[model samples]
Target chain A: MTGSAQPRQPEAGVRYDVFHTDCPARDVVDHVTSRWGVWVLISLRSNDLRFYELRESIQGISEKMLAQTLRALVQDGLVWREVEPATPPQVTYGLTEFGRDIGEPLTELFDRITQRLSPRNAG
Target chain B: MTGSAQPRQPEAGVRYDVFHTDCPARDVVDHVTSRWGVWVLISLRSNDLRFYELRESIQGISEKMLAQTLRALVQDGLVWREVEPATPPQVTYGLTEFGRDIGEPLTELFDRITQRLSPRNAG
Candidate 1:
């Protein structure tokens, strides 16, 4: 077989083939876009927030659910957790560079969707 | 209340406040980014496909789930379902202008996430 006829290797660092079930990117997408995940990311867009602050800002999210969502984002490297050394330890969550890179687009999308569905536009 | 001090009325067409549970745009976001919804939108980004074709393209999606996802997107005005008058009554689905508008960004985000999660980049 000619060199040109050989099958090309899957491009490196591109794991987003939706057709492939084993693609790790699918999990990332699921996590970031999950019910609570979207809210968490958007909440952090403007500023870093403490855990309670996040819960307060995102109405209706349970403490357990918020914790789980934050953990998932942290694992995905999209969020950073900072712990303050104090009598009562404090933790604040902020988007990492990677998180911001993705979060910006998501926030824009969220805004657009909301704009489209508003009462004035619901014709 | 002074004229300048008056609270401005909610702008004409803006519906995406995640903080409010009754916000219509939240439902739009949920449906579009849902487990199967994301795949369906991404799949149709390049080309329109029939029901069966969509089922095949998005691995692991059940007929019930696909139907539900398509229905939600259609209701949200992001997907167009066209039925062909043929022996078997072919049905195809494609993105509406609105769908494309949102799909473009979603697809971009999906690509970015996949790129970041690929094994080669998994440092």
Candidate 2:
């Protein structure tokens, strides 16, 4: 895990180190835990959604930020974008298997934070 | 959960809404999940550490960012800061009960992401 500068070798039992500046995990962590990323993942955990539906569910996110966050998640392969062929083609977003794996913990984290900060729990 | 502009009343069981712009939970989420905050929490989860020790453990964090993140965490009551009276004095940071509660989920999230992004798992 120390200074080998070569690409990660998972087959050799090398672990991806997030503390390393060049690790790909850093990028994934940034995208997944990002402001909009957290909410988007949480929203999609229960159901797939259209762009506008996600926007409405998230309350105050701007359309641009939502679009950007979705794109990033899709690129990272944590989200899948499906386009249906129809008169008015439909575009929907859902978490991929990997996305769901990551999303579960994030959802739990969100619930915990919300619970801790809830009015009843606030001290 | 809909448009109520009044300050939160915890005794009434009103959950703090992260989706709402004015919710205090939103602020806490922004601080705790901020780029540096996640790593900081994960680093401190195993054991308490001094400011310099944290910076060292986290690899690439800047001094200003670390200081800011710690201050925000402390303000949110998730982290406890203890200063010992010595020749130069010593300051150590550790998770408060609430901080550990949140940190566990975050640590899980981090491990999951790292495992997913590892070269062996990357697809």
Candidate 3:
């Protein structure tokens, strides 16, 4: 077989291909755009948080889901999971540089969304 | 009796309050920030689309979910649904001016997200 493989087109007429089921981009989108993912990134923006703290910051997120979500984000390189060798198995989580950069815009978007719906300023 | 009901506190530290289960913002977030909601808004950014057309544009979204999401968005004033009095129930769905304005920023966010994760451009 010749070493040339045909390339597939990106979906939705955008250069991004998250719409495809087999695309790795789908996983990234899931990690970054999920309901908890959105707030998790927002909560981690300005500070480092432990696993439980992250769960606390994002209200109503179950521990199992939070751990799973964080694991995926860490694998995707948007989140860093640090485990300090301590008696209590201390683990802290924070955003990577890429996460920080990407998160700023996302947080801004969230801010705009909230502001638009604010009762005091509702349109 | 003098009416003096104290205002309830919004959830989380942010000025916006989707973190609360009871807040109406949760419903708005569910509709606007959902997996399908993200793409739906992006799809409507540049054009008006009919109900079926929207379903076709967003891959993998179930028709029931899309109908419900669109209905909620319309109620929230983020989308405009027009039902023409005609045969076969010709219904058109499009963004309101408010939707258009909100969608611009959201589309921009999706663009950045896709760009950041592009295989050739992966960090």
Per-prediction TM-score? 0.85, 0.85, 0.82
Off by over 4 Å in 2: A1-15, A85-89, B1-15
Compose the digit string of candidate 2's lDDT tens values, residues B23-111: 77888888878888888888899999999999998878999999999999999988999999987899899999989999988989988
lDDT of 3 at B119: 48
DockQ (Cα-based) per candidate? 0.46, 0.53, 0.34
Error of 1 at B75 (Å): 0.6
Inter-residue clash pairs, candidate 1: none
DockQ winner among the candidates? 2
Residue pairs whose backbone atoms clash in candidate 2:
A119-B10, A120-B10
Q: What is the fnat of candidate 2? A: 0.76
Q: Which ten residues in a row are the worst by lDDT in model 1 chain A? A: A1-10
lDDT of 3 by residue, A1-123 (tens): 343343543343334465655556666766777877877888899899988888777778899999988988899889999999999998999999878876876776766667667755552
Model 3 clash number: 0
Best by lDDT: 2
- DockQ, Cα level, model 2: 0.53
lDDT of 2 by residue, A16-121 (tens): 6787777778889989888788889988999999988999989789999999999999999999999999879988999999999998888788789888777655
Q: What is the C-alpha lDDT of each candidate?
A: 0.83, 0.85, 0.75
